[model samples]
Target: MADTNKQSSEKKEYHKKATGNALTTVKNHSKENDLKLYGSCFCPFVQRVWISLEVKQIPYQYIEVDPYKKPDLLLQINPRGLVPALRHGDWGCYESTVLMEYLEDLSEGQSLLPPQPKTRAHSRLWSDHINRHIIPSFYRFLQEQDQQKQVTLADELKTEIGKIVDVADPTGPFFLGAGISFVDIQMAPWVVRLNRVLKPYRGWPEPEPDSRWAKWVKAIEENEHVRATTSTDELYLDSYERYAENRPNTSQVANSVNSGRGLP
Candidate 1:
């Protein structure tokens, strides 16, 4: 308890500095106390913070940021100009994991991170694994066009999925046995998206061991916090087109120009 309080006090100091910059550049959220979240619907990092906020039962005013044309609020708040920047009254900060760790300390309503240090470390490890290993496969699966490459990407993704499943408590609906934790929230968005993305290819004729993965994927999708973060199907599909279609292309085009190379 003492350690938790100390962590909260320290984070508040960092947040105060960032919030000052955001206000100097743009009008902060009008509500005095509502938490402000700067993010895009398409960013999984931002999605992770959103899920963490949801699981903590923290109320935040969601503000969309166009990553292509980063607004002054985002630039000022993050300085590095990243999404998933968080503001709570006068305290604010950026980086999804930092925001999540801050919330885990601040909110006592539900403890997202485990109290035990070893367990907390494990959660952080898996969170890193999910972000590093699993998320890349997710983007690869999204970008891969050839059916064969998609299938291979799916297989590679299943291996990472197995790693997450290994850490998670299948007996209950979360990472830390019966209770939901920050670990679950951090990884839930991409885990759920895996099911949604691969669903279309499920019924198609395939010889690989995809059906088993499909079952596990469904379980991740059906988890309460995972489902809670969802959008309507029509909206989700439109969002898919917007994100998967344009963002990657824009990044590629920018890289091409900066490198003095032709577009593909």
Candidate 2:
């Protein structure tokens, strides 16, 4: 019991705040507002909503929360004390994908989803694919400690990514072509982590230069909004070290992966 408590305390202390560009973004949005985003810089799920807000030019306050500590205020808003919770006036919403959709419903500055129903549905299908397949595979690959198992998991991750690549637009950049859409923003943070965190720690290889995957990666890397919401690569490496080592972690995603269950 003492060891578990100590580990929890250490995790909370280790992940206190965001740094670099993300820190700048947090400062910019520090002022009080009706729209508030409770998030952590170390979280990719939070990044998804953050990117959506930035891309759509939504006016919002950024409130950093240590999810593991489960502050009273955050628990009131999300109950689960999850980051990526959105508070609008008196109402509150959680879940990264749901928050993105809620922001879209506001009909704010820009539209992340397309106008046509068919295209929007298509976009949603792929986004769900990402949530269900790509992300789970990523964590499984990241948290697997055995080298032989890692090899198999790496291939599974690659296969899932390749499925997306195959369905994406044939031309240069973005999932649905020229303009950035919800799908691109949805998957951007993980793409960043794939290169920054997974490569060095898990021996994940970079996509070939001329490959479609590389093109998509280049687009995500060059996105101004994505860059604004991301912290330095070093911070990401430090944040994910526990997952790489397959050590006990309190994160919902890590727990799900470790237990052979679906991501929460």
Candidate 3:
């Protein structure tokens, strides 16, 4: 009882400090309806959770956390002080991927994980590849300013993309044979952001229309779940363009590339 009261007090304080940001709690939440998310839209990790919530049709309260400001409430819930944390009453959990799985287990909508155990394991493997290889390669390609360095990083990124291509199901659309699954959701943000965000700076050509990679991207873009969670291309550019300014040794390149785009 005391612990529950402490949690309630913390929530009240968090709401008081984070007022005007989107925040809510379920008055009568069952297992399905009792979800609250804390994170920012600018974060891809957060977007993953948002996509799952929208896809699963789970009702949730969203509170946009500013990592720079470091809300006490957020810190109290997640000691690591990371975004993409989930809270259900007094219980809280962090880590975007774990939260995605948690939502999958809790919701009764379309199954995000593959039906077969081996296939599900494969999906998890691909998701690991995305987090380990694709995301880092993407960051390197984007933040690099030197032309020679950019070329090297671009080649590395393509190599990673080629691995994805090799592993992809060549039949038609999504990765897990038929419908969208964990791997697709995991990779969606970076795939959608890649060409739109990096092409100008990296000078890397977009994937050819007939390429498997292109087809994969098209399928995800056309997904209702992805579309609902994604921000506009303009917004992505604007947000990341400012982000580029913060990276050391990339200011000149960021300024030069982002100048004509007129994002304010």
Is 1 or 2 the stronger prediction by lDDT? 2
TM-score of each: 0.70, 0.94, 0.78
Q: Give the better candidate number (2 or 3) by lDDT.
A: 2
Model 1, global lDDT: 0.61
How far does residue 134 in candidate 3 sit from its true spot (Å)? 0.6
Candidate rank order under lDDT: 2, 3, 1
Over 1-264, each residue of candidate 1 has an lDDT whose tens digit, in order, gives: 999898645431101111222232223333444678887655567767766766677656767677557789888787766677887777679878888888887754678877798988889999888767776666665655567766887778778867877667656546777666776677767655554444543322222354444444455566655555554433333344422432334444234433445421
Q: Is candidate 1 or candidate 3 better by lDDT?
A: 3
Best by lDDT: 2
For 1-264, candidate 3 gives per-residue lDDT tens digits of 999898645431111122111121222222343578887655678778877877787777777677546698789878867777888878999888888898888757877997789878888888888877777777766766677877897889889878977888887588866677788889888876876677654566877878888888888888877776665565566656544433432333233333532111
Candidate 2 lowest-lDDT run of ten: 7-16
Superior by TM-score: candidate 1 or candidate 3: 3
Per-candidate alpha-carbon RMSD to the true structure: 14.0, 2.9, 11.8
Name the weakest run of 10 consecutive residues (lDDT summed) in model 3.
12-21
In terms of TM-score, which candidate is strongest?
A: 2
Q: Please, what is the whole-model Cα lDDT of each candidate in the order they appear?
A: 0.61, 0.90, 0.69
